[model samples]
Target: MTSQTDGTAPAEEFMDKVFGDYVGANAIFMAAIGDRLGLFKDLAAAGPATSVELAERTRLAERYLREWLDGMAAAGYLTFDANGGRYAMPADHVPVLAEESGTMFMGAAFFDYSTKFGESFHALLEAFRSGEGVRQELYGQEAAEAIERFTAPWFEHQLVPVWLPLMPEVRTTLEVGARVCDVGCGQGRALIKLAQAFPHCELVGLDRYEPAIQAATENARQAGVGDRVRFEMHDGAAGLPGPFDVITTFDVLHDSADPAGLLRAIHDGLKPSGRYVCVDINCADRSQDNVGPMGTVLYGLSLAYCLPVSLARGGAGLGTCGLPEGRLRAMALEAGFAEVRRLPVDDPFNNVYELSL
Candidate 1:
């Protein structure tokens, strides 16, 4: 290989990275297939089995199962007994794959990357050329469901116990009785969690996407918070129906059509003592500072979904890592928020900001 920039060795190293990424992508697609088919769960529950046994257990075709098993074994996701003709799910992998409610569960992420993001490749390419961007509605239900599953553990396990406690005043208000709204509340998971935690509080969820709103309504009902929580299809950038004691935007601002307008609406929607909890990607203002594994993932997602979705709505197009603490504070101040405080929530994936009128 001839060197284009520095040397042939660097070119070879770059190609190695590209090949590694290709392998990783193939592995993720396989993982998504396994997740969708419940193969991992069955393997974990039924113990080691051959392709034919797994086929009988799952009622899937034998040849397909055989190929999938071989692929998984090669990827180190399963242990293959060549002599016994069986494949086993590793005990350590069970939590990350089969246990949906566990904190380590990452099965949904594979689906998100493989189906939700991968399916949008062509649209993203068009977006790159035209600068018009892909619309949110284009991704549809799969994206919503994938996102819900990806974040469900956080809402279920961490929201009430770990995250809310970081904001004592807001938690106390919820403990009593307070009108709360969650903007961009996909499937209403956070509100459902809040309703379950604080029976006295009135909770409402709002999202621009109709499918998400419908899903949220059904999900809230299923969670038995139907009477307590409400789901509405409304854009927060327009105006919030509020005077809410507490309002939250979880991983929403950067993907919003008008983040500044939404912030202003949130500020106006709140009572004088109301608190706005903004949960966004944890990142630095400068690109150079964000050069690790998390940053790489965030940037790739931005290119695929977040940035384009916002641009399609004629938004500011603040990509995934666009809203660091400094930018958020400045935007909040401009929106007439009197105070903006970064909470002491120790989440690597998200930053918690408390804004008050």
Candidate 2:
């Protein structure tokens, strides 16, 4: 191969990288299919089975199951026994693929990319050409549900026990029956978890998305926290229903149409002694500093969803990696916050910031 740009065979190296990405993409699509069909869960539960046996168990077509099982085995997502003519999901893979409540579960990511991002590809391409953006509503309920599924495990397992304890003062406030609101509260998982943990606290969840609000309300009811928690469709950029003891925004600000306005609203909404907990993508202000797997995922998501969604509404377009600690601190200070501290919570994909008046 002819060398281009660099002395070493650049074309060959680049093509190798491209092929690797292609294989990864195919694996993701396959994973999405398996997740949608409950193939992984069945395989994990039923143990090794021939395609026919698996088909009988899942009530799916044998021919399709055979192809899918072969693909999964090829991708190393499942083990294949040639002599036995059987396939099985590994024990360790069960937590990631089959168990929704497991902390390491990642089944929803496939749906998020294949269903949500794939559906919006043409719109995103148009936005790229016109320097405009795709609207959030265009992604539909699939995106909302995928996001809920992706974040629910974290909220269920970590929010009350792991994350909240980092902010002892806020925990104490909740314990004392403080009024709290979670902005951009998709499906009300966080607030529902909080309600279950701190029974005395009054919790409310707000999101601009109608589908998400509806889901949140239903989910709260299903969790039996309907009376303790309320879900409302409210845009924080316009204002917040306040005098709150504590407020939270999880993975929200970067996708805001008016982040600064929202920050101001949060500041004004809080009581004098209130605290604001801001959870956003873990990122650095400078582009050069962001060079890793998480950074790649965040930046890709920014292009596919976050940036465009915000820009569609005449927003600052602070894509996924835009909000680092320094940027948030400055914005919070300008929005009248007296203190903005990055909490020492150790999370790979998110940063926790505590803002106080």
Candidate 3:
């Protein structure tokens, strides 16, 4: 607590480095260990089990399991019953930490994303500093496949159903046989849904990744929307093939080169009053934990997984994958939107914005 003539050092300054770090930096590592060891969820629904009991039930190494639970208990990731001599996951935290879902859809995958990729975030700062982009070694064809899998099912299962209930505004703006461009559309998921919704709307899914576009085309064909929607290998940064009645970028805007510029291009591509919908998570939603496990992992993915990969071909930084509401609204306004509105979507993990010009 050294006080200087200029000013006194704040308590937060010292405590932040010492004790106030409630979020453990190794939280991802812990999650990975928990998943690998099969420790957390074993005792999750069984109320609580003593370390000895957990070891017996899970046939895990006792001492090692004890240490893990002890650390996890300390971190409030689990609860240890003093008298009952068991550990259990709290109800509030259980759903957030979905363990053992068969297909690796838990928060645990972010650790892999971070370890395999988080360095790019630091490297990105340097790249931005030096006016040189990241190297191309990081993103392979696997990235396109990953994007297809991650976004396709959700778009097919969740988003289309969610938005179908709320497309009066969309229907009003659409003309029969009007051209619809699904910009940055990965695997034509959105277009499939759109084709089904407005059967008469001529739809095209635009993406810079040729592989992605091809996959989207195949998916569109499989989904029976092939004749209605075509996946085009196109560029959003340079421009889009318009004038489109509706331009949709689903979970794609945040990874663009200049999202604002793309919006302008989209605006120009659109007819008089076309709807531009951008679906993504807000990077800076205070309601959600920004630096918490889910947020950081996604941010890392944006840096390593999405941003540079998109830029390697020819695209812009759309909105940092998970940018905030205020920044997104401002970007849309700057892009020459006559009307910009943020529609609250039904996705818990992400938010959707509808910007019209």
Pick the lDDT winner: 1
What is the lDDT of every predicted structure here? 0.89, 0.88, 0.67
Off by over 4 Å in 2: 1-8
Q: Which ten residues in a row have the lowest lDDT in candidate 2?
A: 109-118
For candidate 1, write residues 181-208 as lDDT tens digits: 9999988989998999999999999998
Cα displacement (Å) at residue 273, model 1: 0.8
Deviating ranges (above 4 Å) for candidate 1: 1-6
Each candidate's root-mean-square deviation in Å?
2.1, 1.9, 6.5
Off by over 4 Å in 3: 1-131, 135-138, 172-177, 285-289, 306-322, 346-348
